[model samples]
Target: MKSSRGILCSAVLLIALLAPQCFAEDWLYTVRKGDTIWGLSHKYLKDPLKFQEIQKYNNVKLDRQLPPGVTLKFPMEYLKFAPAEVSVSAINGEAYFVRRGVRATLNKAHKLVLGDILVTNKNSSVALLFADGSELLLGESSELIFDVQTKWGETGMVDSRVRLMQGSAEGRVEHLRGPGANFEVQTPSAVATVRGTEFRVRLDKEDDGIVFNEVNEGTVSVQLHENKESVKEGYGLITSAKLPLAKPKELLAEPKLVNPRSKYLGHPVTLTWQPIDEAKSYQVELFKDKALTTLVHKAQVSSHQVSLPEVNLGEYSLRLRAIDKDGLQGLNTIHHFTISPVPRSPQLKAFDEQYIAGQPLEFSWEESVSATQYRWQLAKDRQFRNIVTQQELKNNTHQLPEGLPAGTYYWRVAAGNIHGFGQYSTLKRFDVKRPKPPELSLSDKTITTEDTLTVDWQAVPLAEQYLWQVSSDETFSNIVSEGKSQTSHLVLEELPESELYIRVAAHGPYNQGRFSETKSVVVEPEGNGKTAFGIGSILLFILIL
Candidate 1:
């Protein structure tokens, strides 16, 4: 009885020790009354293959299943995680500070020096916030810094701040996340902030006296110092030690003129506006009769010059608006000017005249006011592409080149002035005439007797002489006579015995005009045929008759 009681006590001690192990919980776990080894294994261990692990841990047989009220140790391989933070630094000598509800972009890698701010926006204008929940917006040619960095932790925490130095810029505070996240912009004299909406702020490098702020879209509360303060909107707050957020009524300060004679009536014009009251830059708006023509120029400049090319006769005006770094415009102003037209085109006349072949004529024309040069083009065809002469003449006259081929020629001239060259004059046509042809008449049409052949013709109209020939086969190969100078007919006293052909051509100054029709004649003795002399005489009479 004593041994059984001791065994039972030992069994109870072992059960208490292995209660957690038998349950299969990897970490600490308090045993519950209804929990069993199988239930605990399924709940904690999960893997069915590891069900036997409980038996091995307790030094019990596999067949001897897990018992209730036993402890077990479990391994730790399952859990969940979260995203880390991003690392950032500053650029240039600018410092940064950040808290919450702020965002911005860093220009380069840097260590934070000053300014508690965070990135509120990264767009055309970067927004930054201060520890006091103030806001600053950066425009083009602007730089800023942030305070928060990834070294502490990278959990997307609002950590950095920024500052705007040197260039033109704007700032606005929409809504602060809390009282701790206050936003502000620091210049030489004033720190500006807004309760809601948008506003602009600017600072100058050379002189701190030019620091100014404007509330374009929202209300801005400004503090020049702890003692002095003011709020401005739809207007600007100009600040210095003397004036703390003071409101000036008239702001349309005159812009300095840069090159006065920058453009002419026929030249391109460039107009530039000057910065006013130490403002960072200015904008020039050009108008033609009150209509906005162009926002001609914008820059951080003291003056601007506009170019106008070939300005017509009209009235012109230019209006300018001065802008601070905050994008606020001052009163609109105007600069008036005038433009005039140049003189009319010059006149030209091409004289008409006839010329002989190989002879040239002189061409001249009148010039108009302001005519500086003349252009002459001459050609044989009307198209003028076959230009025989394309010369720029300082004088209004040019003699046509001699030895031009015999043909009708066309020519014209143009005048050039400051504005442009005028249209060419009407083309003039001239002729180079060739010599004329002579008139001619033939001699005789027929011949009867062999011994005598009488021929007759008339004189050529414009000829010095006539070219005459007589042939037998109608080809005029056998010439009875060469060119004859006589005006009347020629007698072929010693004529050929065979039939003959005769032709007469007229020669004149130009060419041979026409030729007489060919005439045929048979030259055979009439006598000595059939009673010779008497029969010849009778045949001759019969032929003649």
Candidate 2:
């Protein structure tokens, strides 16, 4: 009897050791706006039909629209065994997690537990391990639940918030509504709150204490939990739980007052001011009135070379401000200028009909009233090479020097005065197309819903029309904006922030050539109010020097 009992005990112990293998795997996936079962199956299982198995096990009926902010789970039997796990924890109101393998997603209703570790997969599913070592893994391609309620024991808590663990997880928050409806995330030291808005949070361990929070729309508040310090609008916050929180300081320097100077209409504006140390770039805003009304032109440039546009006989107010990448604005430096009676539109007629290699090429544009000098450039590629000629011309004709070459050449011209220069003329490319229409490119290609799409492209020919277009499909059959000019290279209005397919095309007359080849741009619209304070250190160093 004793020997038989010993054998049974050994068998029981063996089964207990192998219990983990019996559980299989669990996954968490959040549903986005346009997600389909077919997409989910192919994404996680490499077969759309596999989604059926997942749905049956998860008790989800087929053909249900997996709306945004929904969380779903996949069982172990349907998955292929490449399970991953991550850990997570909640401090303050936000829940933090890390993904190891597989994938994970978040929905609006599911509250993330503090000290939870998650494992992820390619299908955007997640397995959440709580601080108490409890596990909750989602289904493949299922909607996520992004809700938070801190229950002291078994009762539900009110605030619902979570930090991104890994992979891409996007969702909406519905319960946190109204003026007092507050949702937030608390790092070890920092707190991020949502103010009637939708947003995205991405986790990148490689970056040092940098939490990339993007705002698709509405406003978010990133505050130091210890100090309640926060920055508003479209800004980024870089913080770490290991470090103590500091007061939110604006990193922008006060702009120097540019000397009040006279400007001539139809001429390049010579704007010279003491160089600022920490300035990443300068923004020049030209207004028509002393009250700073009727903003005529605004441009952001590293070097100050703003060409005032041809005005229709009126006095205008000018205000210039310098901004760092952190979105901090400096004091506005104001100036005044007047446009005397000028022609309706200035014209640049190419003097040379064609470029005869090895011969002098003389190009001249028709002079406008109140014009003084001309800015000209010669180049091989779109970028100029030789002396960028700025000549004080009483007359319009400029002589091209003899450079013995047997190939085509490109030249560009711009009219300038005291305030600034009018736009540069259409690049005349005898040998090739004039400086490649400013190649519109983006800072980032793939983005979440809460990010912005920064549109850029080659500058349009002076006076030529520029149009910006965006489409879910590559072929921009449905363009976004009607024909507009390229006064500003950036477009940040009414854009659906996501991994959208984008292309920009510049248009001129057929004689000028077909619209320049469409260029691609990617935009990520996220805001956390963390300014670049290091720029201050750099500026201080420059001041010392």
Candidate 3:
């Protein structure tokens, strides 16, 4: 019989082998009363004659049946297993995987095997989740290959290996439970091996054969042909075919946005940010989601200013990072901004008019072709809650009625379509300072029976003209004759032989006063041919009193 020690020379070796292979049960077989090494090898081992190999690892007799309850340790590598699987948890954009040689859509429940290739289109990404809860994000325009997918049977340990052929990928590896757990990423120029970390790997698009590696959490070891460098959290490095593994360089500081009036108000959105000391350039990216997985725009700029062409107004997330002279992109600063689509406010003409109480006010604005209508508001305050007049009309001009209490008033106009409205124009102040105009009074009230009737009104001070109307009714809605006269005297060309109403208003340079009180008149022609006539039932009949 062999000694207590099998092929294992020391207890240290046995412990090393036992601890890492937690599935050591997979290598052991229970001894039965009728079991022999000869019978067991033929049943379990591929080569039956290799029963002697089992004898080297376990002190067992081949010539007799082994005692019951005894256990035999077999090599784990020599055992047989099937292809392993990685559960596909999620995907974004148009990402697919090719199994063996058949292309298929990658879904939540899809399982990927070794030799499977994952691909992402432009502006797309894919997320791969392994059975061990490790997650990997394959970035836009990327291709990744599953090199090895294996797990020791029920050992709670996994060995995952993937090769990035192009573009970028980020990973969040679960903490290893045992020595058998490993996650590795291999690129063209370098390889990254991590026990548990959050990291990113990118093959430089500049065709320099450079691989960029960034560690956000835990530690990552980057290996070139013969050199290796350990990158810790908050640090990054780059490796090229021409150079050795580089020392981990601390990432640059994030750039801070410095625009105070940053509503993203106008076209060609322009934003400025504070510059970093070591930054040679900056990269700006926009995403629609807060998680920043959906990339919309990416650009590299030399200055601290970020300018983007007109984009749809909505909620978005932006990422800004500075690039150093060593071609390493620094840490990112993320922010949430909203782009609200609004129409342009119409331009208003200057308000230079003398205002009077109970007088018409005219306000006009420049034409806006984009607006189908305009909203004009006359308010007591700028907030427009205490509004005097608010209306939406197709025309650009607004007319305020008479009887506005003469104090400081505010007015504004905004252009709008069916979709939405734009910003309101600057509040305009209207100071009602002009005095009420003087009412015109007729000096000569005598009646005349002639075909032409003449009436004279008192010429008021600063009166430029007189506007008189002869109406058939008292309300002056049915005006029979109307004319403007420079003098205070008005002559009626024709006088109807019936009851009529006459009114007149004095006009100044810019505005006209209210019409005078209506006067009812009836003309009586004498039987004798003469210019003298009599007025019958005339209100306020007096001799120029």
Choose the strongest candidate by TM-score: 3
Q: Please report, as a residue range, the 10-residue window in candidate 2 with the lowest summed lDDT.
A: 149-158
Model 2 clashing-pair count: 84
Candidate 1 residue lDDT tens string, 479-501: 66555645656666667566777
lDDT value, candidate 1, whole model: 0.51
Against the unseen true structure, what C-alpha lDDT does each candidate score?
0.51, 0.49, 0.75
User: How would the candidate models be sorted by lDDT, starting from the highest?
Assistant: 3, 1, 2
Candidate 3, overall lDDT? Answer: 0.75
- What tens-digit string does per-residue lDDT give for candidate 3 at 210-328? 98898878999999998899999889999888887778999887898886343543244567899888999998987776766556777889999986655677777888988889877
lDDT preference between candidates 1 and 2, better one:
1
**For every model shown, what is its TM-score relative to the native structure?**
0.28, 0.25, 0.51
Task: Give stretches of model 1 more than 4 Å off.
Answer: 1-162, 177-181, 242-245, 248-281, 284-320, 323-545
Clash count of each predicted structure: 62, 84, 0
Question: Residue 318: error of model 2 in Å?
Answer: 2.0
Better of 1 and 2 by TM-score: 1
In model 3, state the lDDT of residue 47: 64
Whichever of 2 and 3 has more TM-score, that candidate is 3
